[model samples]
Target: MAGLFRRTMDYLYLACVVVGTTALVLISAVIPYAVFTRYVLNSAASWPEPLAILLTIVLTFIGAAAAYRLNLHMNVAYFANKLPPAGRRLLDLLVQLLMAVIALFMIIWGERLVEVTWHNTIADFPFLSVGITYLPIPIGGFCLLLFIIERIFLGLPPDPITHGSEAPSFD
Candidate 1:
């Protein structure tokens, strides 16, 4: 059962990485095109800007979940690291609990936001529903919640080695 759960989470994390990367690439391409069309061609495109904004939202939320799972999210580890091993473990558990709460809030409010905006259409793209743009919020929240649960129960994955000057190797 544990193996099955871990495998499932691994797949989900991979999916998040793929989706986040695709959104990031699309946003990068769209923004430059929007800028070029507006400034270089002297004809501003309406859809690109809004599309890029939506993609950014997707990238941010989805990427955040992946980062959290990988333990790559920004955190202040100074105080926690200074503590003894048991204390550090307790602190880590506490932090995970807090993250779970935040994820729950996102899931609840994000769905509400989607419901409220479901009937509204995007200004730039009349065919696209505004609620569709907000889908990432709840989806990402759910991903984050799953990761939090996995970490709390299964323990964290091993840390990857860093070779850069910013993260020097002690060994």
Candidate 2:
């Protein structure tokens, strides 16, 4: 059962990486096109700016969750590293709990925001609901929640890129 769960999480993390990278690529591609159209073509496109903004939101929230799963999110290690082993473990657990609380808050409030804006459409893209753009908040929260649970129950997974090596890499 534990193996199955770990495998599932591995796949989930991969999916998050793929989706986040794709969103980032799309945002990069769209912005250049928007700039080209506005400056070279002398015609400002309405859809590009809003589309980029929406993709940015997706990239931030979703990519953040993916980063969290990989233990890549920024943390102040100076104070924590000063503690004894047990103390460091306690502090780590406390941080995980705090993160869980924040994820819960995001899920609740994000859903409410989505509900409230469901009827509203984007100004430039009338067919797209304003709420749809907010979906990343709740979705990212759920992903974070899963990662927190995995940490609490199964311990942090080994870093895929580093394996178990502690050696410094110049590359």
Candidate 3:
């Protein structure tokens, strides 16, 4: 059962990474197109602005989720390495819990925002709805939330690479 759970989580994490990568590529392509159309052709690409905005939001969250699963958040661990094992574990748990709380809040607030945007439409891209723009927030929030929960179960260190760290390597 534990193996199954880990595999599932890994699969989800991989999916988020693939999606995020695709979004990044799309953003790069669209932004250049938008710029080229506006300057060279004297007209903006109507879809690029909204698409880029939405893609960026998605990429941010997805990247965050990937980072969380891999325990790749930015932090200095050189000092934490001097601490005793218990102290390190305590600090690790605290950091993980704090991140979990933040993800929870994002999920809650993002859902509300999604609901509000669902009914409306975007100004520049009339064919596309606002819900599409808002979708990334909740989706990323939920993915981050899942990774956070899994991290809690995995008992991750605040900084796994801290000085003299002997913890098993992962991710």
Best by TM-score: 2
lDDT of 2 at 103: 96
The clash count of every prediction, one per candidate, is 0, 0, 0
lDDT of 2 by residue, 126-145 (tens): 99998999999988899889
Report the C-alpha displacement of residue 135, candidate 1, in angstroms.
0.8
Candidate 3, 21-111: lDDT as tens digits: 9999999999999999999999877878878988898889877787777777687998778999999888878887897888888888888
Task: Give the per-residue Cα lDDT of candidate 3 at 127.
Answer: 76
Candidate 2 achieves a global lDDT of 0.90
Q: What stretches of model 1 exceed 4 Å from their correct place? A: 158-171
Instruction: Name the 10 consecutive residues with the lowest summed lDDT in model 2.
Output: 160-169
Sort by TM-score, best first: 2, 1, 3
Report the Cα lDDT for residue 158, model 2.
77
Q: How do the residues 1-171 of candidate 1 rate in per-residue lDDT, one tens digit apiece? A: 878888899899999999999999999899999999999999999889889999999999999999999899888889889999999999889999999999998899999999999999988889989998999999999999999999999987555555568696669
Superior candidate under lDDT, 1 versus 3: 1
TM-score of model number 3 = 0.84
Candidate 3 achieves a global lDDT of 0.80
